[model samples]
Target chain A: MQMTDLPPAFVLFAAAALLAFVRGKARWVIALAAPVLTLADAWAIIDIGASTVVPFMGYQINPVHVHAATPVFATIFCIMLGGGMLFALNQKRQVELPAAFVYAGGALGVCFSGDLISMFIFWEIMTLGSTVVIFSGRQEGSERSGLRYFGLHAVGGVLLLIGIVIVINQRMYAGEVDPLAFRHFHEMVSGWTSLSWESLGMWLVLIGMLINAGAPPFSAWIGDSYPEGSESGSVFLSAFTTKTAIFTLMVGFAGTELLIYLGLWMALYGIVYAILENDMRRILAYSIVNQVGFMMVGIGIGTELAIDGASAHAFAHIIYKALLLMSAGSVLYATGKRKCTELGGLYRTMPVTMWCGIIGALAISSFPLTSGFTTKSMIVAAVSEQGAVMADLGQSHNHLIVAWFLLEAASAGVFLHAGIKFPWFVFFQKDSGLRPPEVPWNMRTAMIIFAAFCVLLGVFPGPLYEILPYKGVAAKFGATVYSFEHVMQMLGLLLFSGLSFFVLLPMLKRTETISLDFDWIWRKGVPRFWNEVAMPILQTLNRAQKAIFDFFPGAGSESRLPPELARRIGTNWAVSVPVLTITMMLLLYLVVYFVVPMLT
Target chain B: MSDPIRKYLNLNDPKLIKWYWIVGLIVLGIIMAVDLAVHHHAHFAKDGIDIDTTPEFYPLYGFAASFFLVIVAKTLSIALKRKDSYYADD
Candidate 1:
C-alpha cells in the first residue's frame, strides 16, 4: 500500500514508535510534523465514501472513510494535537508526548472508521493511550487513578463489543447488506420509548458511549481521573475521549429520547460539583461533563440543525476547553499548585496567561462575540424549534420547553462555575503570595492560538458552519446566531450570573476539600466492604473448617499425624499416584463386567 | 514580570480592585437596561409560557438560578465535603 493510502492514524503511531528511541531535536520535529501530516491525510478524505477497506474474517472493515461529521471532528482533532504538542515541547516526561499522539490518532481514526469492528479497535486503542498519558503524570496518586481510568474504559469497551457483536449477528441472520457498517440505528429513533429485548444490543452500545460521554452515575470518572494527569497530559485527556463519544453518538444513536434526560442531568450535575470544587483542574474537569451534556442534548433532539449544532459545538468545545486547561496547566507548571485554595495573583507576572484564560472563560460562558455564543446557542435554538414542531404535531412538547429553560439556566451556570470561578479563584482571589513568572513561550503560543480561534470563530462562524454535517441548516442558523435579541439575552443572563457569583461569593469560597461523587462507591465503599465485612467472615469459616478437621482421627491439629493424613493436610501430592489409583479401579470394573460375561 | 505590565494586571492593588468592581457593575447595568428594551419573542409561545418572554426574564432567572445552585451546593457540602486527602489516605 502507498504511504498516503495507509490509515491516517498510522502516521501518528509511526511517530510514537520513533519517539520511543529518538531523542533531542529529532523528537521535537516528529512531535510537530506528525500532527500536521495527519491533518493533511485527514482533510484529503473529506468525500463521503469508502477510501480504504481491508478484508478480515470474510468481512470488509474500512479504516479510512468519511462520515458526514468526519471533516469537522477530524480537523479539530488534528488542530488540538498540534496545539497540545506545542504546549508540551518543554515536557521532560518522554512517555507523555508519545501517548498523547496515540490518543489523538485513535480519536482521528474513529472519525474515519466505516465499520463497527474498526471503530471498536480504535476505541480501545484510545483507552490504552489515555491511560498511559495519565500514568506519565508521575504524580503521587497517578498510578492508582490511571488504573481506575483503564478499568472503567475496559468495562465500557466490553459493553460496546458485546453490542457490536449482537448487532452484526442480527444483521447477518437477517441477510442484510454490509452487516458491519457503522451507521444510525433508525430503530432507536423510531422506537425510542420501547425497551424490548430486540433492541438490547443498541441499548448496550448507547450505554457504552454514554459512559465515555460522562453521562451520570458514571460521570464522576471524568473528575476522578482527569485531574491526576500532568498539566499537558490533562489537556490532551480533556479533548479526545468525550468528544469522540459525542461523534459516535451523533452517528449511531442520534435521536434516542433517553439522552435528553441523561444530558440534562449531566449538565446540572457538572455545575453543582464544579461550584463546590477547590482544585482548579477538577473544576475544569467537571465543566467538561457539563459541556458534553449540551452536546448530548443536541444529539438527542436529532434534527438536521441539532446534529449540526452538536458537531459544531464539539469542534468549538475541544479548542476552548484545551485553551482553558492550558491556562490551568500553565499555572500548575509554574507553581506546582492545582488548587484554587493555594493559587492566586499570578496574573501580574503572567498577563498573557491571564488574558488567554479570561478569553477561554468568556467563550465557555457563551458571552456575545466569543466561540461559545455562536456555537452553543444553536443547541438552545434547536430545542425551541423542535418544541414548535412537536406542538404543531399536537404531541406532548412540555419536555422540550423544560429542556430549553434548563439549557438557558445551564448557560448561566457555566458562567458561574467555569467562566468566573476558574479565573476568579486562580488569578484574582485573595493573594496566596505566589508570584511565579509566566509560563514558557511554547505554552503561551498554544494558548494564544486557541484563544484567537475562540474569538475568530465567534466573529466569523461561516467557515466552521460550512464544514458542519448539515451545512445548510448551520449556515442558516449562523445568520441568526448574532441576532440582536439573542445577544441581549445572553449578555443579560451571563452578566447577572456574574453578579450572582459575587453575591454568593461567601458560599462559593474554596475549601481544601472535595465533595463526594458517585465514584465513592468503587473508590471507598466496595473496598471498605471487602476489608471490614467479607474478610473476617472468611477467616472465621477457615477456623471452623480447621476445628472439624481437629476432631477427626489422626487429623487433629495437636496430634502426630500418619503419613496419609500428613500428605492430605500438608499439601503433598504426586500426579502419577492419583492417576494410577483411578486407572486401577476402572480396569477392575472393566474386567469384572466384560470377562465374567464372556465366561458365562 | 516587568513593572509596567504588573501594574496593569495586578488586582492586588486596592485601586485596581475598586475599578474592577465599578467597571463590572456598570457593564452589568448596561446589559440589564439593553435587555429591557429588546423584545424577546417567547420560545414556547405556542405552549402559553409567556413568562419566558417577559421583560428581563433571563436576568432574573440567571440571578435566582445561580443563587439557588450555590445555596444547594453549600448545603450539600456540609455532609459530602471531605479533606482532599480523603482518597489518598486509602
Candidate 2:
C-alpha cells in the first residue's frame, strides 16, 4: 500500500496500544522510535501531491491531506514528541508514555485531517489523550484538575460537533457539492454581519478553536492543569494542545477581525498573570497563552506574508517553548520543587540545565541569536507589512495600528515576565541553598537539541521559512529578519526591558500567592454557590419530602420491609429512592410505547 | 563538589553582582546608541502618531511597558492574590 493509505497518526496510536503490553527498556525503544517512524511516513505522504481521499461512511474523508501549514506544525510536533519522550526516559509513570503517544497521535491526526468530521474526531481524541496524561500525574488534586480540564474540553468538543453538524446540514440543503470540506471560513466571516445558519455554525467553530488556543475566560486551564502533571508530563502537556488549536485557527479562521482583539487580550493577560505567578511551570503555562497571542494576531492579519509569519512562528514556538518547559521540567524533576520561592542557586551544580535554561530563556525572550528572534520578528514584520499595504490602499485600518503598538509593547512584556523571570529566579536569585544535581543524560540531551535549534533557527531561518505556507513571502521576510536595523531595534527593546526588571527588582519580589483568575469562579464560585445556595435549598426540599415520606405506608410498614431492601433504602434512601423512581418512569414509557400506541 | 560554574555566575558574590550590572548597563547603553545609527521604521504611521520612528523609541517603550506591566500586576494582586493554600483544600 502507498504511504498515503496509512495516516501517520495511526502509527503513534498503534504504538500507544503496543506500549501498554510491553515492559522495561523495550517500551522505551518503541515510544522513542514511534515519532521517527511516523515522521518518515508523514514526509513520504506529504511528498506525494495533493490529498488521498477515500469514501468513509458515505462521505469522502481525506485523512492524510497536507496543507501548507501542515508540514511545519507536523515537523515540530514530531520533534517535540521525540524530545519529550527523551526527557521522560527515567520516569516510573508507566501509563504516561502511552497516554502521551495517544495525545501526540491525535495532534498529528488533525495535521492531516481534510474534513470536518475527521477533524472533530481527532480533536476529541486529543482531548482524551491529554486528559489521561493529566490524570497520569496522580499527585494531590490531579484527578480533579484533570476532570475539570476534560469537562471544559468536552464542552468545547460538543460545540464543535454541533457546529459541524449544522454546517453540513445547511450545506446539503444548499446543494453544495463538498458539504463537509474543512477549509478557511473567509466567506462565512465576511458575511457574519448577516445572521444565517452558516455564520452561526462558523462562529461556534471559531469559539471551539479559541477555547483550545487559551483565549480569555477559559485561559485559566493552561495554568491550572499543566503544572499538575508529573515533571516530564508537563513538558509533554505543553507542546500539543494550544499549538494544535493555533494550527486549526490559522487554517479555518485566518484574517477574522475578532481574533485580533481576543489575541491581544491573551497577550497582555499572560504577561500580567505570569508576572504574578509563583509556580515555575504555571508561569511558563501563562506565557504559552501570551505567545499564542502573537500567532493569533498574525492569523488575524490574513495576508499571505502574515499567515506565513504565524505558521513559521508556530514552528519556532513549539521548539523553544518545549525547550523552556524541558529545562523547567529538569529543575522540577531534580528538586521535586516547582515553586520559584523554593528554587534558587542552581547555576553552580546543574551547569548543563542552567546553561540550557539560559539558552531557552534567551530564545523565548527573542534574544538576538535565539530561535525566537528570527521567527517572532516575522509576525511583527507581517503586521507592519500589512499595515503598509492597508495605508497604501487607504482603507480604515485603525485596529491594525492599535494591534501593532500593543503587540510591540507585549513583546517587551514577554521578555520582562518570562524571558528574564524564568532563568533568573530559578538559577541565580537568592541562594535557597538547594544544590540539586544536574538532570539525567537523556533529559540534558533533549534540552541541548532544542537549545541548539533555538539558536540555529535564529541565525539561519531559511530552512523554516522554506516550509511556510507562502514560501516567497516567508523567504523574503527571513532575508530582512537579521538586518542591522531590525536586530538593533529588537535588542534595544528587549535589553531595556531587562534593565526595567533590575530597576523593578524590589517590586518584582516573589510572593507565595496565586493571582486568582476566571477559573476561581467555576472552581470556587460555582461550587460555593452550590454549597451555600443551591444545596441548601435542595436539602430543605429533601427534608420536607422525607417528612412526608416518613408518614407513608404507616411508617411501621416501611420500617418492616425486607431486611436487605430496608438496609439498601434506609441509609441511602435519598439517592436510591430517586433512582428507583426513574426506573419506574422508564418502565412506564416502555409500556406506553408498546401497548398504548397499538391500542390507539 | 568542586563546581566551577557556581564561582563563575554566582550573583551572591558582591563583586560579581557589581560587574554584572555594570556590564549589563554598558550593553544597554551601547544598544541604545546603535539605535541612532539605524533608521527606525514606523509600523503604523498613517493612522497613529509616528512614535516608533524616533531614535531610542524601542528602548524607552520597552522599559516603560515592562515597568507598567509589573506595577499593574502588583496592583491586581491586591484583589486577586490569595494565599498559596487558597486552593489547597480542592
Best by TM-score: 2
Top-DockQ structure, candidate number: 2
Show where candidate 1 strays beyond 4 Å: A547-600, B1-5, B13-16
Name the lDDT value of residue B72 in candidate 1.
Answer: 82
Please give, for residues A161-199, the per-residue lDDT of candidate 2 as tens digits. 888888888889999988888888877557656767548
Please list all clashing residue pairs in model 1, or write none if there are none.
none
Where does candidate 2 stray beyond 4 Å?
A: A193-198, A543-563, A566-600, B1-5
How large is the interface RMSD of candidate 2?
1.5
Clashing pairs in 2: A371-A454
| Model 2, residue B86: C-alpha shift (Å) | 0.9
Write down the worst ten-residue block by lDDT for model 1 chain B: B4-13
**Poorest lDDT segment (10 consecutive residues) of candidate 2 chain A:** A552-561
Give per-model TM-scores.
0.92, 0.93
What are the per-residue Cα lDDT tens digits for candidate 1 across A1-600? 665467789889998899888889998898999999988877766743447888878888888878999999999999999999999989889899999989988998898898999999999999999999999988777999999999999999999999999999999999999889999999998897888988989888888898999998999999988999999999999999999999999999888888888989999989999999999999999999999999999999999988998999999999999999999999999999998989988777678888899999999998888999889999999999999999999999788988998999999999999999999999888778888988899999999999999999999999999999999999899888888998888888888998999888888888899999889999999999999999999889767755654554655334444568668788433333345458778999999999999999
